[model samples]
Target: MLVGYARVSTQEQETHAQTDALRNAGVGFIFSEKRSGGSMAKRPALEEMLTKIGAGDTVVVYKLDRIARSLKDLLIIIERIEAAGAEFRSLTELIDTRSPAGRMFFQIVGAFAEFERELIRERTRVGMAAAMRRGVKMGRPTAMSEAEEAEAMRLWFTGDYTKIALARRYGTHISSIKRAIKRYRERHQPSLLDAA
Candidate 1:
């Protein structure tokens, strides 16, 4: 059996090209998903396909990066495939783990992928640090201003309005209102452990 796996990193992306290539390669069954390959635990389709594969089966992917985000992940996936008595194949890389040369080449490519990821991480960290030095704030804008949050907390304490009602009044989520109240309490009152 030739089982294909196709993945795209984000919901905005589509796996059509990968599926088409896998179909053209004569793959009978193809599992596809629009999810980040960064975490193997999160990709249910890939996990299902792996669990279904048996001896004499080949697990195929359009590209190596589509299947794994790092070398360790790639090796772990390959190990699982081989342990199931199944072969691994990458369409674009021309890698087939059935041969010794192919396995070596795949590991080499996986290593480079890991290195590239590390480089990207390092660059992002450096860029963010530089931005911070220039007084740039990261992350999403706050849902409410401090004064709004304070008023919300006050209204919450009065018990006249439910957290949901407070959220509606403030145009924020209930969770945001809860967080504001929690923050107010934390600042105004010390924890039991602190008193102890």
Candidate 2:
């Protein structure tokens, strides 16, 4: 029995192409979804497909990355398939776990995948650090504007609004409101550094 799995990282990505490829490969049953490959928990279809496999069954996929986000994840899924007495196959990469050479090649591919991921991560960190060095902020923009923070601080000081109320009004968190209040107090109060 050939059971296929197809996946896309986002809803914007089309899965029909992968589905067609899997079907053309003579896969009778296919499970597909648009879900992030970042983690197993994010892909329910993949999890369900794994549970349905049995001895002599071959699990097919369009590509390795469609079923796995990282080398560790790929190995984990392959281990499960092997434990279930099933085989694994990738259409594009032409990997068939039934052969000894294919198994060794799969491991090599995993090593290359891990290496590629590390390179990407390193590049991203270096780029972010460079942006920061250039005085560019490198995170989500504040939900509450500076003007809104000032208004929240004023309202908080007037004792007219609660922390939760301020957060809801400004579409922010109670923690953010607290931080704004703290900043307001620090600015208003005389610091020891200023005294010195």
Candidate 3:
């Protein structure tokens, strides 16, 4: 049995190209998803397809990245397919994990992924270090000034108004009001508890 998997990262994207490719590859059953590749949890169809696939079956995908974005993720899925006594095939890359050559290619790809990750980490560290040397502040920009935050806390501590009412009065979101109050309480908490 040959089963197909097709994925599109966004709801607005079409899976037609991948589906058509899978059908052309002679896949009898197809599972498609319109979920991002960042999280496997969002792809229910892929999960169901994995559950249904078994030994002696072939799982076909249009592209390697269509199945998974990272090498580690690709390896995990490949391991699952191999453990199930099934084969994995990628139409675009012409990879067939049932063959020895294909397995070697997969290892090569995994090495590149690891190299790429290391490069990314190095680049990020260098960039952050440069930013620190230049005294460039990083992190969320304050939506409200310190004075506004203090005034919001003062109003809240007086117990004269509800959170929603305070938010409406100050023309700020209720969430902002709640966060301000939370931060204020955390900062003013007794030091005895901190020692404990």
Candidate 3 achieves a global lDDT of 0.85
RMSD values, in order shown: 2.5, 4.9, 4.1
Candidates 2 and 3 compared: the better one by TM-score is 2
Candidate order (lDDT): 1, 2, 3
- Looking at model 2, residue 105 earns an lDDT score of 95
Off by over 4 Å in 3: 1-46, 62-73, 169-173, 190-196
Q: Give the Cα lDDT of each candidate.
A: 0.91, 0.90, 0.85
lDDT of 1 by residue, 91-113 (tens): 99899999899999999988987
Poorly placed runs, candidate 1 (over 4 Å): 10-12, 182-196
lDDT string for model 3 (15-83, tens) is 899999999989998999898987777889988988889989999999787888777778888888888
Candidate 1 is scored at a TM of: 0.84
Clashing pairs in 1: none
User: What lDDT does model 1 reach?
Assistant: 0.91
List, residue by residue over 67-96, the lDDT tens digit for candidate 2.
997888999999999999999999988899
Estimate the TM-score of every prediction: 0.84, 0.74, 0.67
Q: State the displacement of the C-alpha of residue 44, model 2, in Å, after optimal TM-score superposition.
A: 2.9
